[model samples]
Target chain A: MAFASALKCRECGREYPTDPLNVCEFCFGPLEVAYDYEAISRAISRERIQNGPLTMWRYQDLLPVDGDHAVDLQTGFTPLMKAPNLGRLLGLDHLYIKNDAVNPTNSFKDRVVSVASTKALEYEFKTLACASTGNLAGSVAAHAARAGMNAYIFIPADLERGKVVGAAIYGPTLVAINGSYDDVNRLCSELADTYPWAFVNINMRPYYAEGSKTLGYEVAEQLGWQAPAHCIVPSASGSMFTKIWKGLKEFEDLELIPKVHTHMHMTQAAGCAPIAEAYEAGVTRVRPVKPNSIAKSLAIGNPADGYYSLKTIQESDGDATIVPEDEVVAGIQMLAENEGIFTETAGGVVISGLKRLVERGAIKRDEVTVAYITGNGLKTLEAVEDTVRSVTIDPTTSSFEEQVLNA
Target chain B: MGVTVRIPAPLRRVTNDQDRVEVDAENLADMVDAMEEQFPGIKERLIDETGSLRHFVNIYVNGEDVQFLQGLETAIKASDEVSIVPAVAGG
Candidate 1:
């Protein structure tokens, strides 16, 4: 049985039944899935989770879905390895990388889409739709294909070619709008009212967002049932950043962990860093900006959870950093060269923001820090296409040595 | 044809369950005023105390956001279709 009890409004503290509703009718605030923790505490344990499935469904007790026949694709339980090479270079001792890029769809969006798709089926919805920047489009389409549902994926027209092809490969009805991600989201909101399809990120968001807590669950469990000292995550809509922290705290509340003092740091590209800018200005109001960044995946200017993310950062005593557009490529190169992990622009923002935080003394040298790498580099080849250098030589030993080796 | 304003589901209660209302107004500001005059308490929800559009409320004129146009002063023709949509939480 699912432990989720109600969908509660984040702002007005209003509660409603666990339906496919994201926004509160009265306050217009986001509705979050509120679980029956007392029952979950009795049902879940370390031994139970360890004995569960190897995928994200292992934390099914904490998630909002009933995991009878989930829309699984071997999504989560990604590697959490110590990054000594990256750590030593960044002047740190205890540094690890939560490599979520190795997921089925090559991004962390799979986790949420997996849960959302399962919930959509439970609600008897035939169509799965979403307004994606890039990664989510691919994830939602893949899940819809697995569930045998019709998929309608919408995105900004100028998205990455790899991401567009990635979603299209699943045979979803991909619509590319000639505007920004925010514009596409607004249009989808209107469409959600007219259609009976389940928009994963819109109508099904209350349950969709609960899937991110598995990241936190895995991190703590992989670390021998203890929360790390610091967690640096990439922020777009700020949902994942806040949910990761929420996962850690939920474990603490359930007596699964002693206590979580993890500092949640958020990173963003300078071109579209509204949450980071709000945190920097010591305010709760996030002023939206026109996105102009190479990190198109993290280019949501008007973030929905910007206010709550700021509140999470302040509550956790965490910091937010913005990476310059030029340094984004450098950050990607840094991780690739140092740790042999080729990550996309969002990961680059995390690594670059990590450097800034370390340089500014916000993160101590010996603290346990886990840097989240959310996407694979293959999807964003254009961001680092200029860094490629190839030599043209004939099939001769002498020509190879002279052109490639000597040069 | 007149300026037809489409009310979102949340604000339909104030409009007496009327999904669409025909209002005679020149611009967005006058439209909000007319809506308040008809609905009695909707202006406070659409516009904040500072007299600016609330952050969570979006006003679209013929599928174009008013923020992209002249905002409150955006001229409205008689045949325009206005929609008041609530901002969605991100994906």
Candidate 2:
């Protein structure tokens, strides 16, 4: 059942009908997808949700779209594994990893793109488009292909080669702007105003943002209907971070989770850690940065939801921190080595930030923690290209034994 | 009460196609008043009737967001450059 009632501004109390609108016309605040909780409680139950499809649509009551179509690549409902190995290594008793790299487009961006494209169809937009740092571009293109709509993706010219190829392979018109992700986004904003295309994170952002709620819902459900003590998520535009918090609150409000006290930590590359910087300084506003991190995907200098993300973290009693580039690479290696989960640079930020917190005792040893891995490692081979190397030896048992033992 | 206002491309008409304009104001609120004095309708684009900065419009003083410093009460130094940039999104 579709329970989304209207799109409401997050800042001001004004509301608008459920339309392809992202901002409040009056105060120009970001719009959020609002649902009638009374209707949702009557429409859905724990058993009903568990008995539904394994995809993200299982929480259709929480999302904006109907379950029949518009867009669905079987995204979400990803593996929520108990990382006993990583936990032992980090000296934490209970730790889990929300590995979203297994999505169809190989990142959590698929979750947002799916709902955005579907909402776009509802709005009768002929084209799906976005200005992305990296991951969203590929997801938008892939979903557009599946929905049989024209896709136009704009991205920074110097993004990872794999990500560029990833979007281009999906048959989208990829435009590479000659500047930072901020520059690309500025151009896309202008284009969004002029063109009739549904810029997913712009025109359809209220719905696009709702899809990330499924992550929080899935985590609690997978944990047998209880929220974790700590959760670390990578932040760029900070939309995903804020939505995940709303998702957990919605679950508790709907009685899916008895109560939620999850402390939401935010991770960022130090090169582009505006939100983290604000958080550490005990400030409310985020000062923009010129991004210069290997984690290009999470390198939005001026994150749109930066202030709100900081608010969520602070209100949840969570800490926000920045990871150096070297630590980011170490993080990717640590996760792969300990948990066998290869993740992109954003995941690197999360994993590394998690490690830093654990090391500093910010996250206690006994806390039930969850680290979100948002993208695949294949998208960022350049990050580990220098640190990870291969020693080629002759295809002989003697050479194999000697080299293997020596190393 | 003198400060430089950096306008973005879209709102260039507020400054007569000039990217940067010198405005006389002691704080952001005064600056908004000074701007509206020159350009009739551009102030609405920057702030709402309730006098809060527009969510889409970002005002930075010396590279720091005004909401962090003191909102409209943030002190405006003669050397400080105030830039009005729109919020960028997507990924």
At residue B80, candidate 1 shows an lDDT of 96
lDDT score for residue B20 of model 1: 91
Write down the worst ten-residue block by lDDT for model 1 chain A: A21-30
Clashes of 2: 0
Query: Which segments of model 2 are wrong by more than 4 Å?
Result: A393-407, B1-45, B48-55, B59-86
User: Which lDDT tens digits does candidate 2 get at residues A1-407?
Assistant: 27888888888779898977676644557888788889989888899999989989888878888777749999999999999988999899999999999999999999999988998888788999999998999999999999999999999999999899999999999999998888777667657766889999888888898889889999999989899999999999998998889899989998888878899999998888989999989888677778899899998888999888988997789889899877898889889999999999999899989989898888988888999999999999988888877789989988988987666
Question: In candidate 2, how many Å is residue A192 off?
Answer: 0.6
Pairs in clash, predicted candidate 1: none
What is the docking quality class of candidate 2? acceptable
List iRMS for all predictions: 2.1, 4.3
lDDT of 2 at B67: 57
lDDT of 2 at A42: 88
Error of 1 at B3 (Å): 3.2
